[model samples]
Target: MKKKLLNQPTFLLGTIITSIMLLMTFIGFFYTPYDPTQMDNSNKLAGCSLEHIMGCDNFGRDIFSRVLQGMGNTFLIAVATVTIGVVCGILLGAFTGYFGGWIDEVIMRIIDVIFAFPSILLALVFVSIFGTGKYNVVFALGIAFIPSFARIVRSEFIKYKDMDYVKSARLAGVSDLRIMFVHILPNTMTVLLSSIMIGFNNAVLSEAGMSYLGIGVQPPDASLGSMLSEAQSYLFSAPNYAIFPGVMIILLVLGFSLMADGLKSR
Candidate 1:
């Protein structure tokens, strides 16, 4: 069943959307209709036409250009958040799982405490205290996701630690680091890859949520979240404004989710 789903055209469409968004990220760096941060008072609220494919925003800025630029900003935030979370999770989980003692107890307890609150709520708290900005948003999102990565990696480590190769590595006087990396880490990678993919998707959504609340990337910086927030006010007259960014987010998330599921099944 999973194989059939993997083979389907919808999955291909998701893949294509994700690929195109990434392509736009790099392509947008060198080209855009106008600087996304620049405002044109005269062009404000211009409707879709030959001059503006997606139309102009309330500020008369090009919606299509902003969306393109926003994709780049969004990609960077997602990559940073996920990279930090996954790396921290892997190291902490390895230490806790491989050495299982007071170390494991303390780490797990801390993870449990962090998990007690809803992630977005926790992030909101951080954002509120730090004030809204790009770094704050990234930090809030990264920290919010740490516990899940830690827990997942810890579980993977626990499963692989008892395997014969690990036991042999220990007996052979392989350094603990060597055993963890040379033996355990590689074995746990399948699960980790899937976790990272899901983490990437979550990072995208989390950033959007923060932006919607005015805590994410500031205005003038294009991001799907900020774009959606701006479009909400014009949904009646410029439905395409909301629709395009919304679909981009959905497709990006769906692609990663599907790829994660496929890897897990294998």
Candidate 2:
């Protein structure tokens, strides 16, 4: 059943689409048809043509080039956010789980408090406080996700703390750090990887959302969210403007989701 599910068409498509997008992102770093940020006001809003594929945006920047570059920025933000959330979460969870008592209660309470608010709202609040930019957006998104990752790690720790291996390590006078990382962490990797994948997808979406709302990565840097936001105003006439970035976002999200599911099933 698991193998069949992993081999499904949707899964394959997700994988392929994600790979291609990622490839484009790397390729974009070195070469593209034109500068993604360049504005040619004279040629603004041109339709797809031999010279300008994917049309020109309102500012006359090549949509294709901008989209590719935007994907790259999106990837950067997602990676940073996930890394921050995961590392901090794991450390906090391990401490709270292994030590228990007041430590666990304090950590769990913090997680509860953060989780009380919707993540998006929390992100918005952070972004507003910090001011808008790529770094600020990543920081906001990362902070928003810490509670989830911490909670998951705490659960894993609670589940495995009393196993025979842990007991043996404890009796052998293994350092708490060693026991946590060497004995416990390895067991948690499967769940951690799945959680990180979920985090990745959420980070991308959240960053895109903030950008669309004009509170995220600034102009001069093409972001899928920013593009979509701009496209919204011209929906009736330039439906393609919104459609392309929207599809890319969906593809990326679906890709992470499928890969996460595959890992969990394994």
How does each model score on TM-score?
0.92, 0.93
The total number of steric clashes, by the backbone 3 Å criterion, in model 1 comes to 3
> Candidate 2's residue-wise lDDT over 6-84, tens digit each?
5876656667777887898898777889998889998788887888878888888898888888888888999999998
Please identify model 2 stretches exceeding 4 Å from their true place: 1-13
lDDT of 1 by residue, 95-175 (tens): 998889998999899989988888789888988898888888788788878889999888888888988988888999999
Off by over 4 Å in 1: 1-14
Model 1 TM-score relative to the real fold: 0.92
Q: Please, what is the whole-model Cα lDDT of each candidate in the order they appear?
A: 0.84, 0.86
Top model number, TM-score: 2
Clashing pairs in 1: 43-60, 44-60, 70-222
